[model samples]
Target: MSVTKGLVKVIKLEELKPQIGKEVQVLDQTIAIFRLTNDEVRAVSNRCPHKNGPLAEGIVSGEFVFCPLHDWKISLTTGEVQKPDNGCITTYETAVIDGYVYIGEPIQHEKHDPSR
Candidate 1:
């Protein structure tokens, strides 16, 4: 994956199908990428916050995806669980440039030093 100005290239724009979700791995994190009907792109955690369901396989309706496991509605834009559902998944910024889709920088956590 190529990183430029804090954005990591994930896939080519042509590789993503409109209204479909694609799962991608970045820095050991599973992220779900979506190409909306309007040709816009969105990125969020692949696992649902409720039951670890695979959001990539969910049905996309507008800006929301209904989790395949339990039918929990998740907002593709904000990663927020809909009413009656609790918690949220991580949302990543997405950009398409020169026919390539890019996501924001992955979260970085401080490493633990065993010798410390």
Candidate 2:
């Protein structure tokens, strides 16, 4: 498939497992890519909004993933923290074509301190 101008090819669709999250690094940012059971693709920042948890290691349920550190439920589609939580992580636009996955430029957010 021909890649779009701003999207970077990340992985092949066959390389991703259903309901499993894979971490892809682009430039200096880490992103988590997910292929749901129905073959829909979603991408979000690998860092959790709370505690900077590694979202790639989180549990995937439907379109939401629970943060590994504190069980904060984050929507993979929208990157919004579920109710009772009050922050959001950046969500990247994704495209899948001819079995390849492409990620658009990520939305910029405050950088999280690694030492936290």
lDDT of 2 by residue, 59-105 (tens): 99999999989999998877888877767888888888778999987
TM-scores vs. true structure, each candidate: 0.88, 0.86
Model 1: lowest-lDDT 10 consecutive positions? 106-115
Whole-model Cα lDDT of every candidate shown, in order? 0.87, 0.86
User: How many clashes show up per model?
Assistant: 0, 0
| Residue-wise C-alpha lDDT for candidate 1, range 33-85, written one tens digit per residue | 99999999989999998889999999999999999999999888767788776
Residue pairs of candidate 1 with colliding backbone atoms: none
What does the lDDT read for residue 113 in candidate 1? 38
Task: Look at candidate 2 and give me any clashing residue pairs.
Answer: none
